[model samples]
Target: MKMKTRGNFQLQRVIGYFHGTIILFSIIIGAGIFLAPKGVLKYSSLNVGVSLSIWAACAVVSMVAALSHAELGTTFPRSGAQYYFLKRSLGPLISFSYIWVNLFASPAGTAARSLLLAGYIIHPFYPGCSVPEMPKKCLALAIVWCLGILNARGVKEVTWFQTLSTVVKMAVLCFISLTGIVLLVRGRKENLARFEKAFDAEVPDASQIAEAFLQGLYAYSGWGVLVRIAGELKNPGENIPKCVITALTLVALIYLLVNISYLAVLTPKEIMSSDAVAVTWMDKVIPSMQWAISIGVSSSIFSSLNCTVFSSSRVLYVASQEGQLPLILSTLNVHSCPVVAVLQMTILASFIIIPSDLILLVNYVGFIDWLQLGLMMTGLLKLRFQEPDLPRPYKNLWQLILVLLAGRLLRDTFLHYATVSLYVDPLKKILSNICIRNACVSRQFI
Candidate 1:
C-alpha cells in the first residue's frame, strides 16, 4: 500500500510536456552560459572550431548519461532521484549518503549561483564593485528569501514563474544569437578573427584539455533536475525521456552559438581578462542590447534560483519524511509546499552568499555537483540490474557505456576539488582536510 502524509500531500501531476521542457531548460541556463565561455576561452582561445568542439564533446557525454537517466526515471518516477534509486538498488546506507550530500550541496550551490547573478546585476551600477560587503550579501540573501517565499506559495505558481522567466530568457537569447549572426554577416571585421590565427594559437596539452572539458561540464550540469521532478510529471513514461534529451540538445546548441557570437568580437585574451564577456560582446555588436542581455542573464539566474529552491526543498522534505531530517521540515502548508524546508534552505544559502566570489562559488558548487552526479549515475546503473523487472518506459541500448562515462566524469570533478583544496586558506583547509583524510582512513579501516 502507498503511504500518505498529514497534509494530504497527493503527488502533483499537473505539469505537462511543455512545463517539463521549460523547467529542464531553466535548470540548464544558469550563470554557466555567461561565465563558462570566458573560462573555456582562457584555456583554448576563441577558435570557433575548438570552442564548438568542446561543447559538442560535453553534449555527447551528457546525452549518453541523460539517456540512461531517462530509462531510470521512467522506471521509478519518484521525487528523490538518487535516494530512491540507491535504496532500491544498493541499500539504505548508500541512499542515505547520497541524500546527505545532496542536502548540503544543492541549496548551497543554488544560493551561490543566485548571488553570482546578483553580483553581476550590481556590477554595472556600482563603481568598481569587486569587494564583498554586507550590502551585497544582504541583497543576495534577500533574493534567496524572496524566492523561498514564492516557492512556499505553491508549485503551480512557481512553475508559472519559471515558464514566464524561461520564455523571456529564450527570447533575449534568440535576439542576441540573431543579432550576432547579422553583425558577423555585415563585415564586422572588428569581431571576426583570422581562422588560422584563432586555431593556431597555443594548443592545449592533455591536462589543459581535460581542465577545459571539466569547466564546460560544470556549466552543463543541472539538466537532470527535470528528472528530479519525474513523479510530478504528467506522463512520466514519454515526457521524461523526451524532455531531458531535447532540453540538453537545445542548450548545447545555444551555448555553442552564443560562444561563437562572443568570439566573433572579443579575442581570447580579451574574453579571459573580462568578467562580463557577454556584456562585452554585446557592447561591441549592439551597445543598446547590452542592458537587455544583462537583464536577461540576471533573469536567467533568478529563474534558476527559484527552480532550485523549489526542487531541492522537496528533496529535504522527502528526507524529513523518511526521518533523515527533522520532522518539522517535512510539514507542508495549505499549498502543499514544504515551508520549513524552504526556510531552512534559504537561511543556509544566505550564509554562503556572505563570501561572494561568484566564480569561486560556481567552481566549488560545480565540483560537488559533479561528484553527486557521478554517484547518481552509479545508482542508476545499480538499479537497472537489481530492478530488472521494474517497468521502464524508455530504455537506452548504450546504458553500460553511458554508465562508464558517467563514472569517468568523476576524474574531472576530483581534479577540480583537489585544485580548490590546494588554493583555500590553510587553517580552513586543515579542518576540512582532516575530515576528508579521516573519512578516507576510516573507509580503508572498514
Candidate 2:
C-alpha cells in the first residue's frame, strides 16, 4: 500500500474556538429535534417522564462518546477523524472499512435528513397533499448543490454561516421552551399535570424501551462532526476538546427543554399522534407562528446539511491524502477547498434522495453508524495502552462507562430485532448492499 506523503496537500488552519463550537452545535441540533419527540413518546408508552429520562440517558451516552473523541482528536487532530484514529490503533483494514462504509452512508444520511426538510417545507403549503417522490428528490438536489458550492468556496465562509445558523436555531428552541413555561404559569393545568401520571400506567417491554433509546440517540447523532475537520481549526489540540464538550452539553440541554416544551403544549397522546411536534406546539400557542416555525426548522436542517457536506468532504480529502483513496479526490481548488470530494459527496447524496422512505433511511443507517462508533471507541481504548507516552489534552475518564453503554446498546438492539423476523431479514439485505457498494469503490483504487 502507498503511504501518505504530507507534501501532497496543504490545509489552512483558520477556524477558531468559537467558530468550532458553533459548527458542532449546528450539526447536532438538526431536524431531528423538530420530528423525533413523537417517537420517544410512542416508544416509551406515552409516559412524559420516562420519555424525558430516556432523552437524558441518551445524552449521557453521547457525551461519553464525545469525551472519547475529544481525547483522540486532540492527540491526533487530523481530518480523517475516526479513520485516522482507527488506523493508528487497529490497522489499515479497519480504517479502510470505515472509509468505505462512510463513503455512501454519510451522504445517504444527509439525503435522508434533507428529504425530511423538504417534507416539512411542503407540508405547510400543501397540508394533506401527498408530495410525489420526484419533487422531494428535486428539492433535496437543490439543497445538496447549494451547500456543496458554499463549502467549496472556503472554510471561513462555512464557519460564518454555521455560527449564524446555530444562533438562530438555539433562539427558536429557547423561545419554545420559555413559552411552555409561561403557559404552565398561566394555569395551563392539563399539560403540566400529565407529569403526575407519567408512570401511572403499565410500562412497555424492555425491547420497546431500547428501541426508543435508539431513536433518541439518532437525534443526538452529529456530535462528532467537529473532530472530522480538526485540521482546519486554530489551536486544534485545545479547541477540539473545548468544542466537543461545550457543544454536547448545550445540545443535550436544548433537546431536553424542547421535549419538555412539546409535552407542555400537547398531551402525550397528542404528541404521539401529531406529525410535526414543533409546528403543532406553535399552532396550539399561536396559529400565526406556523410559517415562522417552519422557517426555523428548515433553517436548522439547512445548517446541518451544510456542515455534513463540509465534514464529509474533509474526510474524503483526508482518505485520499492518506493513500487510502484515489489521489484525485485530494486535489484542492484555488479556494483551498476539496472540490472533487465535494462533488463526489453531492452526487452520492443525490442518488440516495431519489428512492427511499424517511423511516427506512433512518433505520437502515442506524446499525452501521453505531457499530462504527463502537469500533472507533474500542480503538481509542487500545491506543491508551499502546501509546502510553502520547500527549492528550483531554482524558477519556468515562471509558468504562462508555463500554457498558455500548454493550447494552448492541445487546438490546440484537434482542429487539431477534424476535422480529422482519427486521432480521433486512439486516442481511443492508449488509449485502453495503458490501456491494464497498467493492465498487475499492475497484477504483485498484
Candidate 3:
C-alpha cells in the first residue's frame, strides 16, 4: 500500500472480507432497484422480455467493469481509488481532474440521494401533489448532518449500520421475490406469462435502448466500493477482488430475481403507472405490510447516502495526505474516523441543497464519473504496458469493458446533451465557469 503521503494518521483495517462484502453490497443495491424497475421497463418499451434482458446485460457489463477495478485496487492497494490509480498511471493532472470534478459532483450525488430519502419520507403527507422542495431540502440537510455525524462516530458504527441497512434491504427484496415464488408454487403461472414473448413488442430504437441501458447501469453504478476504500480492508490485495466480485454477483442476482417477481405479480399497466413499484406491488399482494416495504425503501436510500459521505471523505483525506489539500483533512478524530473530511463532505452537501435543480446537477456532474472510469480503464492498460512486471494479483477483463464504456460515454454524451437542451439557457451560464473552476479547484487550499 502506498503511504507516501505525509500523514501519521492511519486508518485501521477493521473491515474483513465478509463485512467488506456487506458494505459494498449495501452501497451498490441502493433505492434504485425499488424505484428504477418501472423506469427501466418503461424505457424498454414495456416489453417484459426486453426489460429483463436489459437488466441482465447491464449486470454483465457492471461485473466486467468492477473486476477491472478490482485488478486496479489490488495493484495499487490504496485508499483514494480513482485518484490514486490515475495519479500513478495516467499522471497527476488527470488524477487532479478526477478529484477536482468530484469535489463538485460527489456532493451533488450525496445531496440527491438524501433529498430522495426526504421525498420518500414526506410523500405520504401530500399524496397526489408534488412534494414541496423547501421541506424536502430541509429534511435532506437534516439527514445529511445525521449521517455525517454517524460516520464521524467511528467506522465500526458506520459498518454496523451498513449491515443493518443491507439486511433490511435484502429482507424487503426477498419478501417481494418470495411472493412471486409462492405464486408459482401454488400453480398461479398467470403472472409468469409476461415473459412469454420477451422481444415480441416494438423494440426500442438505438437511442432509446441506449437510454434504457443507462438506467439499468445507473442501478449498478456503485459496484466499485471495495476498491474505493481499499486501504481500510484487511488483506486488500487478496480481498478486494473477492469482495467486489462476490458483492456484485449477489446484487445482480437479487436485482434480476426482484425484477422477475415484479413482472410476474403486477400487470403491465400497474408496473408502468406506479413510480414506487415495490410499494404498489406490496399494496396489491399484502396490503397490511405496506409500511414495512416503505421503511425498507427508506433504509435503502439512507444507506446509500451514508455511504457517499463515508467514502467521498476518504478522497479529501487522501488528497490531504498527498499534500494536495489542507493538512486538517488528514487528521483523524478519537473515533478513528476522518472527522474533518466527513464534515467537509457533509457541509458541502448541505450547501448544494440551495439549488432547486439537484437532479440536473446530478445529471450534469455524472459525466465526470464516466470520464474517471474511462481514465482508470485506459490508465491501467497503460500501467500494464509500462510496468509489465508490476505485481497484479487480480487480472482484468475489460477489453470489452472499454468498448462498452466508450459506447456509453458517446451515447450518454448525446443523451445528456439532449437533456441539457431543455436547459440550454442555464447550461450555457454554468458552462462558462467550468473551465476556470476545474483548473483552479486543484489549487484551492482548505
Candidate 4:
C-alpha cells in the first residue's frame, strides 16, 4: 500500500488542481481572519472606512503577489517555492536565510495559532475558570502531534481533512455574512449607519498605516502554501495559476464580507475592545446562537493548524532535497510523507508553545514572514530581467508594480523599526545591566 525511502525519496505527484486549491484555501482562510479585524480597526486610527480600505488593499496586493508566485510555480514546478526562487535568483545566502527564519517562524506561528485554538475550545467550558499555562501548552503540543501524524499517514488523508475543514469554516463565515445582511435588510438602521462616519476621527500617519497594513496582511499570510507543494500538483504550470487566482479572489471576497458583517452588527469601540470579535457579535445578535462562535473559532483554528504543519513540513523536506538541510530530513516513510521533517516541525512548535504566549509569536513570525515575502517578490523581479527566456505560462506587468511597492514598504518599515529601536535599545541595556549588577551584589553579600 505504501513505499518507504531512505534517501532521495520522491514526493508523490497525486495532488490535482482542485486539491491544490483546497490546500491553498485552507492555509489562507485560517483563524487569523476571525481575529484580524480587531487589530486592523484598533491600529488604524479608529476609522471604519480606513480600516476596511486597508483590508481590501492588502487583498489586492496579495493577489499581485499570488500572480507572481503562480508564474514561479509554473516555471520552476518545484517544492520549497520561495527558497528555490531565492536560491536561483538571489543566491544561496538569501535562500538559506529565508529557510533559517522559516525554521523558527513557521512552527512558532503555528504554535501560536494552536494555542489560540485550545483557548477557544476551552473558553466555553470554563467561562470563569482560568486556564493554567502548562495545560494550554500540553494541549497545543497534542494538537500539533495529532496533525503531524495525520499528515504522515498520506497526502490524500490530509487533503480530505483540509477540504472538509475549509468548507466548514466557509459555511460559518457565510452564515455570519448572511445573517448580518438580513439584519440590515430588516431595518437595522443604526448598525448599518455606522459606516457613515467612517472617517470621523483623526487620521493615522504613514507609519501607523503601514503597521495596520502589516496586521491585515498577516491574516492573508498563507497564500504561499501552494508554492511549497508545487511539485505534487498535476500539470502545475497551468493549474497553479488557475488555483492561485480562484482561491485568492474567493478568499478576498469572503474576507470583505466577513468584515462588513462584523461592522454591521458591532460598534467600532465594541470591535476594538473585543478579544473574540465573532463571539462578541454573535452574543449580541442572538444569545442562544453564541455557541456557534466558539465552534466556528475552534474549527477555524484546527484547519489553520493542519495547513501550517503540512506546508511547513514541505518546506523543510524541500530544503533537505536541495542539501540546505540534513539528508535525514529528506527521508520519507511508507506513505511518501516526509516523517522526519514533520517531526522536526512538531518539536519546534512544541517548544514555542511552552514559554512564549500567543501575541509574541504572532508579531515575531508575522514580521519575519512579511520580510521574507518582500524578499521573495524582489527575487521574482530579478528572475524576470535576468532570465528573460524562461518559459512562464503566465506573466504580468503588475508583478513589477508589486515588487516596487514591496521594496518601498520594506524600506520604510526597516527605518521605522530602526529609529524606534535606537531609543529603546539603550533603555533595555541599562535595565539588563542593572539586573546583573543586583545579582552580583547579592552574591557578594552572601
Candidate 5:
C-alpha cells in the first residue's frame, strides 16, 4: 500500500511541522551545551565576555549556515544532507567521500556522546571515586542498541522520544536560567559581578580565540539537522526555514542564558574545573534538585543519542537507495523503518566505542563535519550559479558565512596541530572515519 520509487520502498511524510522542529531542537541541543562552556572558557583564557561573545558569534554563524541549508533543503529535500548536495552540485567523486566519512563519523560521534552520557550517569553512583571504562562503555553500547532498536522500530517512536527529551531539556535549561537570573536580581552577584569587568582582561591570542570558537561551534553542532530529515517534513520548503528560525533561535537563546546561569552561582574557576557544570550550579543553589538535574542531563543525552542515530542512519539508507551500497540496507520493515541501516550503525558504534575518548572524537568529527560544511557551501554556490531558476522558496547569502566558517575551522585545525605528533591525531580521526574495512581511503580527500 506504500508508494515505491525506483523499485525501492518510499518514506512517508509523517513528520509534521512541530515534530520536525523537535527533531532539530533536540539534536542541536545535545550535551555540547551542558559541557562545552568549560572548553570555551579555558581556551579563551577564562575571559567571560570573550567566551560569551564566542557563544553569540557561534550562534550567528550557525544561523547563517542553517539558513543556507534551509535553502538547499527546500531545493533537494532528500535524505542525505551533504552527500546529496555534493552529488547534485559538485560531482560524484567528492560526494562519495561523504558517505564513507559518515559511516565512521556518525558512529564515532554517536559513541562519544553515548560515552559522555554513560560517564555522567554512572559516575554519580561511585560517589567520590572514578568510574571504570568497562562500565561506561558497556552502558554506552547498551544505549546505542536500545536507541537503535527504537529507530529500527519506527520513525514515529523515535520522534516521540525525541520530542519528550526536547521538552525535558528545554524545561530543565529554562529553570536553571531563571534561577540564575533571579539570584542576580536579588544582589547575589558573586560571579555575576565579574561581568562588569568581563572584557577588562587582555584579549586571548588568535589561536586561543580560535580554539574557543571551535568549542562554541561544537555546542552548535546540530545546526544542520533539518536537511538530514528534509524529506520527512510535511512541507519541507515552508517548514525548513520555519524550523531553522524557530529551533535555532530557541537553542541559541537557551545556550547563552544557561552559560550565564552557570556563572551566576559558580565562579569561573569552579566552572572551568567542573566535570558537570549544571550539577555544580545546582549544588550551590538547590542541593536537593541536583539529583533530578543529573537524570535530566542523562535524559537529554539519551534523546540526543537517539536523534543522532536517527539522522545518521538516513545517510546510510540513502546510500543504499542510490545503489552505492547493497539494496538490503535501504529495505524498510512493516513500520517503514530502515532496520538494516539502523542495525549496521549500532554494530559499528558498538565496536569502536571501546576507544571512545570524548575530546578526540569531538576533534575528529568536528574537522570532518566542518570540511563537509565547506563543500556544501561550495556546492551551494555552484547550484546558485548553474540553476538560477531553481525553485527555492527560501534564499539567503548565508552560504558565504558558511564558507568563511569553514575557512576559520580549517585555519584552527592546522594551528592546533602544529607538531607532527600532534597533527597525527586529526589524521588518525580522518582515517578512522573513512577507513573501516581493509580498504584505505585516498589522502587527497583530506
Candidate 6:
C-alpha cells in the first residue's frame, strides 16, 4: 500500500471573502424560502411570530454547528471536511462511509431543489407544469450537464457567473424587502390587521408546532457548505468562521424580514395554502413585478446548483485522493477540477430530479446532515482534548455549550426520524432507498 501524498495538484485558492460569503449564502437560501413558508404556516397556523421565532431558533442551532465546524476546518484545513476530520480524529472507514453518503445525498438534494425550481419557472408559461408529468427531469439533467461542463473547464470560468447570479438574486430580495416595508407604511390597514391577527393566533397542537419547527429548520440547512470548501478558501482559519457565522446571521435576518413581508401582504391562511407564496405575494402587492421574482428565483436556484455541484465534487475528489475511493475520481483536468467526480455526482443528482420528490429529498438529506453535524461537533471537542497544542486560528471557549447543543440536535434528529417512520412511512422508505443506493454506488466506485 503506497502512501498517498499531496502531489502536483495544488488546490486552488481563488475564492476571496466576498465570493466565499455569497457562495455559502446562495447554497443555504435556495428553494427553501419558497417551499418552507407554506409548511411553516400550515403547522404553526400562519402565526408569523412563532414562524419567525422558529427560523431564528433553527439558525442559532445551525450557527453553533457551523462554528464548531469552523474550528475543525481551521484545524484540518483540508479538502474533504468531514472526511478529513473523521479520518484524523476517528479512522478511515468511518470517514469514507460518511463521504459516500454525502456524495449520494447532498448533491442529489441540491439537484432535486434545482429541478423543483425549474418546474416553478416553467409553470407560468406552460400552465400544465407539474414535476412528475413534465420534462423537469430532462431540464434538471441539462442543468447538471451544463454545470458539470463548466466545472470541468475550470473554477475561474464559473466564479464570475456565481458572483453575478448571487448579486442579482440578492438585489431582487432587497427590492422585495424594501417594497414590502413601503407598502406596509402606506397604510394598508386591512392587510396590517390581518397580519397582526395571524401573528397572534393561538398555538396549534404540540405535534403541529414541532412539525413546523422542523420545516423551518430544514429551510435553514446547508450552512455546512462553507466547511466543504475549506481547502479552497483563502485564510481558512479566519475566514471560515467569519463567513459561516456572518452568512447565517444574514440569512436569519432575511428569512425573518421576508416572511414578515409575506404576512404583511397576505393572510396566514393564504400564505399556507399557496403553492408559490413569494410570487403570489408579489402578484397581490405589485402584480407587474411577477417576472422579477420569477427571474430571481431562477437565478438563485441556478447559482445554488452550480455551487453545490462544485463543493460536492471536491468532497468526493478528496475522498478519492485519500484512497477512500477509486483513484479515477481524483483525477483533475487542466482546470484543476475533478471531472470524474463531477460527472458521477451529476448523474446521481439527475436521478433525484427525475423522481420529482424535492421535499422528500430535502428531509432525507437533512436527517443525515444533522447527524453528520453532531458528529462534527463531537469531533471538535475531541480535537480540543487530544491536540491541545494544534495551531487553531479561532478557538471557542463555549465548548461545553456547543456540545450540549449538539446533543440536543442529535436527539432532535432521531426523534424526527422516528416521527417520520411512524406517520409518514413512505418518506421513511424513500430515505432508506437513498441510503441503500448511496452505499451501492460508493462500493461500485471503490
For all candidates, the clash counts are 2, 0, 0, 0, 0, 0
What does candidate 5's lDDT look like per residue over 1-446, in tens digits?
24234455677888877998888888888889877888888888888899899999999988887888777778888876556778778886676677777877888888888888888888667754667889988998888889877887788888888878887887888899898788778875475587878887668988778777777888888767778877777888898889888988999999998988887787779887776778777878887777778888898888888888888878788877776667778877777777788888899889878875566567667777788888888888888899999888888887876788788778867655545424566755565444643223342432
- Where does candidate 5 stray beyond 4 Å? 1-8, 418-446
Name the regions of candidate 4 deviating beyond 4 angstroms: 1-3, 6-8, 128-134, 355-360, 415-446
Give the C-alpha lDDT of model 5.
0.79
**Residue pair clashes in candidate 5:** none
User: Which candidate, 3 or 5, would have the higher lDDT against the true structure?
Assistant: 5
lDDT of 1 by residue, 180-233 (tens): 687678775566654434566667765556556666876787767766767678
Poorest lDDT segment (10 consecutive residues) of candidate 6: 124-133
Q: Tens digit of lDDT per residue, candidate 3, span 15-41?
A: 999888888888888756865676677
User: What lDDT tens digits, residue by residue, belong to model 6 across residues 1-446?
Assistant: 12224476667887878878888888778778878878777777666677777777877876776776677778778776768888887777668778867866777676777776776676556532333445666666777788778788777876788888888888877877787788788877875786556456777666666566567777777677767778888888888887887888988888877877887788778776565677778888777777788889888878877878888888888888788788888888777788889889877777667565555556566657766766666777787789889888887766567566546555655666666553676755777677777786766655
Residue pairs with backbone overlap in model 4: none
**Best candidate, lDDT:** 5
TM-score of each: 0.89, 0.92, 0.89, 0.89, 0.92, 0.89
Per-residue error for 346 in candidate 3, Å, reads 1.4
For residues 1-446, write the lDDT of model 2, one tens digit per residue. 13224466477888888888888889878967876687677788887778989999989988878877677678877776677888889998788888888888888889888888887677677554555666777887888889888988878788888888877877788899888778767776687687666787558778778777777888888877877887888887888888887888988988888887788788888776666677778888998778888888888999988988898888889888788888889888767888889999998898778755555466546656787777877887788889888888777567666667667777877644445634556854576677778677675664
For each candidate, the alpha-carbon lDDT, in order, equals 0.71, 0.79, 0.76, 0.78, 0.79, 0.74
Off by over 4 Å in 1: 1-7, 45-48, 127-134, 194-196, 412-416, 427-446
Model 1: how far residue 197 lies from native, Å? 3.3
